[model samples]
Target chain A: MAEIRKATGFIDWLDQRLAVNKFIKVMMTEYWIPKNINFLWAMGVVLMVLFMVLIVSGIFLLMYYKPDIKLAFDSVNYTIMQEVEYGWLWRHIHGVSASVIFLVIYIHMFTGIYYGSYKKGREIIWLTGMALFGMFSAEAFSGYMLPWGQMSYWAAQVITNLFGGIPFIGESLVVWIRGDFLVADATLTRFFMLHVLLLPLVILLLIAVHFYSLRVPHVNNQESEEFDFEDEAKKYLTGQKVESKVVPFWPVFLSKDFFVVGVALTIFFYLVCFHYDFAMDPINFEPANNMKTPAHIYPEWYFLWSYEVLRGFFFDIGGVAAMDIGLAAFGFANVIFMLLPFLDRNTDHVAPAHKRPLFFVWFWLLLIDMIVLTVYGKLPPTGNNAWVGFGATITFLVLFILLPIITKMEANCKCNTGGCK
Target chain B: MRELKILAVVIFFTAVVYWGVEPFAHSQMHPHVAPADFAFKDLGVNSKKGDAAKGAETFMSAGCIGCHGVSSQGMAAPMDHASASASFGVVPPDLSTAGAIYDKNFLAALIKDPTKALKVEHKFNESRPHPMIAFFGLGGDIDQEIADIVAYLQSIAPVTPMSDKQVFADACQRCHDIKYDKLMSTTDKEALKAYMGTVPPDLSMMIRSKGTEYLTTFINNPQKQLVGTSMPRVGLSEKAQNQVIAYMEKVGDSKKAEREDLGYKLIGYMVLFTLLAYAWKVKIWREVH
Candidate 1:
C-alpha cells in the first residue's frame, strides 16, 4: 500500500489514532477504476450530488413545513415557496433533484446491464443498488405526499389501494400503511414521517452497503474486460499510469468525474430555472379535495411506465381478476432489474451489448418499450392509447422473461467455440 | 461514433417522451377551455361614452352603495361582512377598485343580470337563481347606466402599476385568502362555504398550478373552465386582471427572476468548471493507457 501523505504533525497523530492515511488510500487514492469507461458512469457521482441537494434543500423546506393535512399544503406552497426568503429556490432545487436522481439511477442501472456489470461476483453490488433504488423510490413517493395537493392526495389514494389486493392482509396492510381507512390526515402524517425520517435512514444505510459491495467487484467499464485491482494499484502507485489500464480514483478518475459532474449541473440548473414543470404537476398545485377527483390522474413521469403496466391489463384469466395480474406485472417490472445478475446466464462470451446481437436488440427494445409505456401512461386510457399501453405492457414482461433464454444461447454459442468453461 | 450512438439514443428517447407527454398528451388531457376575448364580445353590451363627473353622481343614485361599499369614497356597506354574507349569501365586494379590476362591458352585463354576466346561467337558472339582483339599468337606460357606473369605477381606480398584492386584495380578498400573504377572506368562513357550496381555493399557489392561460380563461368565465362552480365572475379590466394574476405569481413563484438569474450564473460557472475539468482530465488521461 502506498503512503497516503508524507506530511507530519497532525497527519502523523491522526494516522496513529485512526489509520487515516490507510483509510484514504483504500477509499480514494488506491481505488482503481477501469480507464475504458464513459460519462454514463459519472451518473453515480451525479446521484450523490443530487441526494445532497435534496437533503440540503429539504432541510430548508423542513424548517417551516407542517405535517398536518390542513397545514401541509400551506406550509409547502405558501411558507416555503412564498413567505420564506428564497423559499421557492429551495423548493425548485429539492423537486428537481428528487426527480432527477431517479433519471440518473435509471441510466446507471441500464449502463450496468449494457456492460454486464451485474453478472457473477458483482451480484451483491447490483442487489444493494436495487435496494437503494427501492429506497429512493420510497423516498420520492413519501416526499411527494408532503405537499398534500390534488395529485398528491389522489395518487396516494390510488397507489395505497393497490396494497388492498393482498387478499387476507391486503386491506389491513393498506389500513396499517395509511393509519386510516381512506387517505386522510393520518395517511398524510405517516407518509410525512416516512418521507422525512425512516425512508432516508434506510436509504443511507443501503448506500453504505452499496458502496462497500462495489469495492470488491468494482465498476464495470464500457468493455467487459476484467482487471486485477491489486496489480493495477501497484502500477498506479509506481506512477506507471500510461502503461496501466486503470486510473487512481483521486486525481486521475476524479478529474473525468468532475467534468461529467459539471455538465450534469449545467443541465440541472437549466431545468430548475426554465423547465421545472417536469417535476411539478399542475394538478398538484390545487389543494387536496377528496370530494372531487381530477379528470385524468397519473403518476410522476418516473413511475409512469410501471403505472401503465398496472392500468394496462383489463382482461380476466382463469377467473382471476385482470387487475391482480396487472398488479403482479407492475411489481415484476420493479423487481426484475435486481434479477438481471441471475438472468444473464453467466455468459463467458459476454462483452458489451453491441458485441452481442440478441442482447443488444433486447436492451434497445426494453428502453424504447419503457419510454412508450411512460408516454401512453400520461394519456387518457381510451381507444388507441389503451391498445398501445397493453401492447407495451406485454412487451415489457415478455422482454424480461426472454432475457435468460437469449443470454443462454449466447453463452452456448461462444462457449462452444472454446471449452464452455 | 460509439458516444454518438448513445447520445443519439438518449436524444431520440427524450424527444419521444417530451413530444408525447408534454405537448401531445397535455393538449389531449386539458383542452383549451376558453378562447381569449379582450373585447368581451359575448357579453352583448352596447358601447357608450359618459362623463366621469356624471358617473360619480349616478354611481350613488343607482343604489349600488346599498349592498356594496365604496371604500375609496368613504362609504361603507349597509351591513358588516357576516351580516351581509348571511343576507346576500356572500359578502358584497367593496367597489373601491371595481373599475380597476372588472371589464367595463362585463360590468355592464353583470349590472343587467348577475347570473348572465358571470356566465353561470347553466348553474343558476330561474329556480336556483343567483343571489344578486340585476341592476344594469338602475335609472332609465341599461347601457347608459352601465356606462356611467363603469366610468365612475374607472375614474376612482388607482392608476396602473399598483402593487400586485394590493390588486389581489381589492379583487380576490373579499372571497379568497392568500394565506402566504396573511390576508384572510373578508367574509366569514361558514357564510362563504354556505354560499359558494365549497370554500374557495387559496390563490397563493394558483399561478403555479392553474397557470396564466388557464387562470385567464377561468377568470374570464368560471363556467367555461369549471362548468358548475359557484364562483361568480369578478369583472376586472384588462390591466387589473393581469395585475391580479401577477400578484398570484408573486406569492406562487416569487423568486422566479432570482431563480432564472441564478440558473444562468450556475450554468456559466459549470461551463468554466467543466472546461477546467476537461483540461485536467485530458492531462490525466494522457498519463493513462
Candidate 2:
C-alpha cells in the first residue's frame, strides 16, 4: 500500500497493522459526492435509519409476541400493551416504521425516475433497488400476518388465493406456499421465518450492493454532463493531473445526511410516541376469525395501486378466469417496472429533470394513475370505481409502453432543433 | 460552531415535536378505539342464550314501554305517526318490525346505555339528543337483561319470514340497484342523488364486500356507524339485523367461515433471528470507532 499521508503514535501503530485510516480515508473522508444533490438524495440515509429502527423494535416485539393462533392476538393486543414494559412503544415503532419506510421508498423511487438515475451505468444500482423493493414487499406482507388480525388473515387468504388463479399447478402452488390446504400455523411459521430472517437478510445484502454500485458509478446529480469519477480517481492515483469539481463525502454530504436523519427520526419518534395508529387499519384490531371475513379485504395503502389493477379485470375471457388474467397482467406490469432500464433505451447521461421532458411527463402521469388506483382500490369495487380502475389500468400500461418511444422522439426532436449539447 | 448550533436547533425542534405536536397526533391516531377496549371479535359472542318469554318481562320492567310500543295495540305516547314524530323529532319507530331490523349486539348496547353506545359504538355526536337513557340503571347483570329484551323483541315481529331476495328487495332495492332490469328512471335517480348528496351504494355484493359485522352495526344506525351519513337511523331490532345478515350471507360470501386461521410461531422465529441479527451487527461493526 502507498503511504500518501503521515500518522503518529497509536494511529501510526494501527495504520501499520490494520490500514483502518486508509479504509476510512478512501470510503468516508476522501469519498466524493455530487454537490447539487437535493433532499431526495437524503432518503437513502433515511431508509438506512428506518431499517435500523425496524430491526431494533422488531426484536423487542418478538420477545413478547406469541406465534400461536390462539395466543397471537392476545400477545399483541394485551400482553404487549399491558404486560411488557414500554412494549407499546416498541410495537408502535415497528408497526409505524413499516409503513413510513415504504412511504420514503416511494418518494426515493419517484426521485430516481424523475432524475433518470436508472440510466446507463447505474443499471445495477437500479436493479438492486428494485430487488430490495420486491424483498421489502414480501417482508411487509409476511410481517403484516404476524399480528394474526382480521385484515392479516383475510389478506393472506386473498393474496395466496391470487396464485390459485394461475392455470394448472396453481392450487398445488398455493398449498405449497401456505404449507397446508389454507393459511394456518405452517404458513404463519414460514412467513415468520421469511419476514424476520430470510427476506431482511436478502434486503440488507441487496442494499449493500445497491450502495456499492451507486458509489462506483457516483451519485447522479442535477447536471447534464456525466462526471466520470473513476477516470479522475485513476489519474489522481497515478500522480497525474486531475480536475473535477466534487465535494467530500464527510462533512459536506455527511452533515446533510445527518440533518435529514435527525428530522426523519424526529417525525418518526413523534409518530411512535403519539400518532402510532395514523396509517393503521381499524379492522386489524379484531382477532383472526376463520368463520367471518371483514366487509372489505384491502392490502396496506402501498399495495393498493396493484390491487386496483387486479380488480379492474372483472370479466373472464373465453375459458380463463378474469382474476387469472388480472394476476398475469399485474405480474407483467411488475416485470416491466423491473426491466425499466432496458425498456428505456436512452443512452443520454442527462440527470436534469427538464432535460428529460418525456420521462418527466410520463412519470408524473404514472404517479397520478397510481394515486387514483390506490383510492379506487380502497373503495368497494362497484359503479364508478370499477370504471375508474379500468381507465387507470389502461393509462398505467400506456405510460410504460410509450416511455421508450417518447424519450427517443424527444431526443431526436432536441437534436434537430440544435438543443442537444 | 455553526454545526453545533444547527444540531442544537434540531434537538430542540425534535423535543418540541415530541412533547407538543406528538400528544395531539397520538390522540388523533387513536380516535377510533382505545387499546384498553375489548376487541370487536370478542364482542360477537353472547355468554347466555336469551329466552323470549323471560325477555318480555324484563322489557316492560326496563321502561321500554314508555317510549316504544308493540304494533298499535298497547301504547304510551299516542300511537299516531304525527304525535310520535312531534315527541321524538323523528317518529319513534314501532317495535313490531324491530325483530327484523336491529342487531342483537346493537340492541344490547342501545338498551343498556343509549347515549354512551351511540357516542362510542356508533360514533354519534355527543350533543345529539338521545331519547333512550340507561334502562338497567346503575348495574347488576345488565347483560342478561339486555339479552332478554333483545330476545323478546325478536319474538314479537317479522311474522312473515321473508326470503333473502325479498328482504334485499324491500330494504335495499329502492335506493340501490341489484339487477339492471328494475333500474330507477334517470330523473328520479338524479333527484335522489341530489337530495342525498351521494349516490347510494349497491347491495348486490354488500355482504361479500363489507363483511357481516360491518353490515350488522351499520344497519342498526347509519349515523352511529358512520357519522354525517345521510342514511337515517333505521331503528332495526336485533332480530332484524340477524335476519338481514343471514339473508345477505346466503346471497353472497357464504363461505366466509372457511377462512383459515393464523398462528404465532413467526414471533418466536423473529426473536431468534433478532438475537442472531444483533450479534451479527455487533460483530461486523466491532472494528469501527
Candidate 3:
C-alpha cells in the first residue's frame, strides 16, 4: 500500500486497529478493473444489489409468514396483506424481485457465454457461477412453496414426486426432502428453513468464491486482452506507476455501477408499482388444496426451458419411465452449460463471437430453441406441443454436442483465407 | 457535486417508483371487486325464481325423461349398462340424484351443449361422441327452459343435509371403496367392474383426489368430464350437489374458508412495506453515492 497523510479522526482511530482503510483501498478504492468493459459487465453488480433487496425484503416477510401448511397461505394472504402495515408492498417486491433477479442472471449468463467469459483461467469462476445458478433455482423453488397457494402446493408436489422417477431410493428421497409422506406442514417448514437460511448461505458462500476467482483473472473485456495482475500490483505498491489501462474501483466504476443500478431500479420499481401481478399466475391466489390440481401447472418462467426439456420425453424408453428420461435430459442440459469452459477447444485467446461465424450460428440457434421451449412448456402437453418439444430438444442437444466439432472444422477450413472459394 | 446529482436522481426515481407506480401495481394485483349492479334482486331470466309445477312440464318437454328416469330404481333408457357402453362407449349415469349432484350453472350449461359446454367451461379434454345433443337447438327461450328444469329437479329432491358418511354411501360408495374409513358396506365389486370395465376408486380420499369443482361437475355429467368413462351422469339438484360438496369439504378441506379468508389481509400489508423499504433504500444510498 502507498504511504499517505495520517488520518485525523474516527476513521484513523478505527483504521489503526481494524485495517479498514487498507481493506477499502485494496478491495474498492485502488482495485483495478478493465476500462473497456461494457454495460453487460454491470449485471453482476446489479445482481448483487438485487440479492440484497430480496434478502432484506424476505426477512421482513418472514416476520409475519406462517410456515404451517394450513395457515401459510392465510398468513401471507390475510395477516401480512391486511394486518401488517406496508406488508403487501414488501410481499409484492419480494415476489416481483424473484423474477427480476432471474432476468438479470439470464442476461449475465448470456453475456458470459457471448464473450467466452468462461474460457481458460476463469473456469473456476464459471463453475462457481453455475453452482450459484443451481442454488438460486433451488432457493426460488423452495421460497415459491412458502406461499402455500395452489400453484405453490401442486408445484411442490410435482417437483418432489419427480424424485420418485429415480428408480430405487427415489420414493424415500422424496419423503426425506418433504420431511413427510406428502407436502404437508412438515414440508413447508423444512422448505422455509432452506429458502430462508440454508440455500441463501450456500449462495452467499458461492458468490464470495465467484467474486474472488473473478478478481484474479480481472474482468474479461470485449477486446479480451491479457494483463499481469502481479506486475500491476507490484508497480502500485512500489509507488512507481500513477496510471495504466485500468480504472479505479471507486469514483469511475462505482459511479457507473450506481447509474446502472438507478436505471435498473427505475424499471424494477415501475413493474412492482404498475404490473406487479404481470408474472404471477392468478390460480396461485387460491389457497393450497391438495385434492384439486390446477389445469396447468407450470414453473416460474426462468425454469420453463428446463421444464420443457423435462416434459419433452413423453414416451417411455424400454422399461424406464419417460419422465425419468426427461429429468436426466434436463440435468444434462445444465451439465453441458457447466462444461462449456472445457468444450470450447478454440486456442485463440480473444475470438469474439461475431468473428466466429459457425459458433455464432450455433449460439443463436440454442438461444431461440430455449425461447421456443419456454413457450411450449407453458402450454398444456397437447399433441402439437409434444412434437415441438421433441424437435426443440433434439435441436438443443445437437447444437451443444456439435459445437466442438464445428469449432474444429472451422479451424481446419481455409475459407477465411479466400482460398476455398 | 457529482455525488449530489446521483443522489438526486436516486431520490427522484425512488419517488416515482413509490408514488407513481404503487397504486397501479396494487390495482393490478387486486383488481377484483363486487360489481356495482350486484344485488339481492334477480338480474336476468336465469336468476328469476321458477315454479316447480311449470318446471316439471318444461323438463318433460325438453326431452330430459328420454335419458333420465325420475326414480333411482331403474334405467329410463331401453339399453342397460352393457349395451349402452358398447354404443356410447359408456352408459350414461342415472339422474336419480341429479338434483343433489350437479351445480345449477353446470346443469344449465350442459342442457345447451353437453360436449362444448364441458370443454369450454371446465377444460374437459375427453374425446367421446356426443350422445345428448343440445335440447335448446330449437332456440326458443332456452334460459327459461333450463331455469324451469332446474326448479323441477330441485322440487323433487331438495338437498337435505346429510352426514359425510351418508353422502359417501348414497353417492360414491357403489363404485368406490373407502379404504381408510369404513363408511359404506362393500358393494358387488365384480358386477360393477364388469359394467364399468374398471373398479370404482375409493371415496376415502376422493374429495382429496379430485377437486371439489371437478367432483361436482363430474357427478352432474360424467361423460362431459371423462368422455368414455363407464360412470353415468347423476343429475343431483344444485342444493343437493352443494350439500355433497359441503360433506366433501368436511372430510377433506375443512379449513378452506379460513385459509382463503386470511389471504386478503396478508396481501394488504405487503403493499405498505414496499413503499417504506423504497424510501429507506433511497435514504441509505444517498450517502453512499
| Candidate that scores best on lDDT | 1
Report the candidate with higher DockQ, 1 versus 2: 1
Per-residue lDDT over A348-393 for candidate 3, one digit per residue giving the tens place of the 0 to 100 score: 4445566667777877788778777776766666777789988898
The lowest-lDDT stretch of 10 consecutive residues in candidate 1 chain A is A412-421
Better of 2 and 3 by lDDT: 3
Which 10 residues in a row give candidate 2 chain A its minimum summed lDDT?
A: A236-245
Could you report the Cα RMSD, in angstroms, for every candidate shown?
3.2, 17.2, 12.6
lDDT (Cα, 0-100) at A259 in candidate 3: 59
| DockQ score for model 3 | 0.04
C-alpha lDDT of all candidate models, in order: 0.83, 0.67, 0.68
Ranking by TM-score: 1, 3, 2
What DockQ, on C-alphas, does every prediction get? 0.69, 0.03, 0.04
Ranking by lDDT: 1, 3, 2
Better of 1 and 2 by TM-score: 1
Query: How would you encode candidate 3's per-residue C-alpha lDDT over B18-88 as one tens digit per residue?
Result: 33223433343334333211111221225656667887778777776665556643437555645554554
What DockQ class does candidate 2 belong to? incorrect
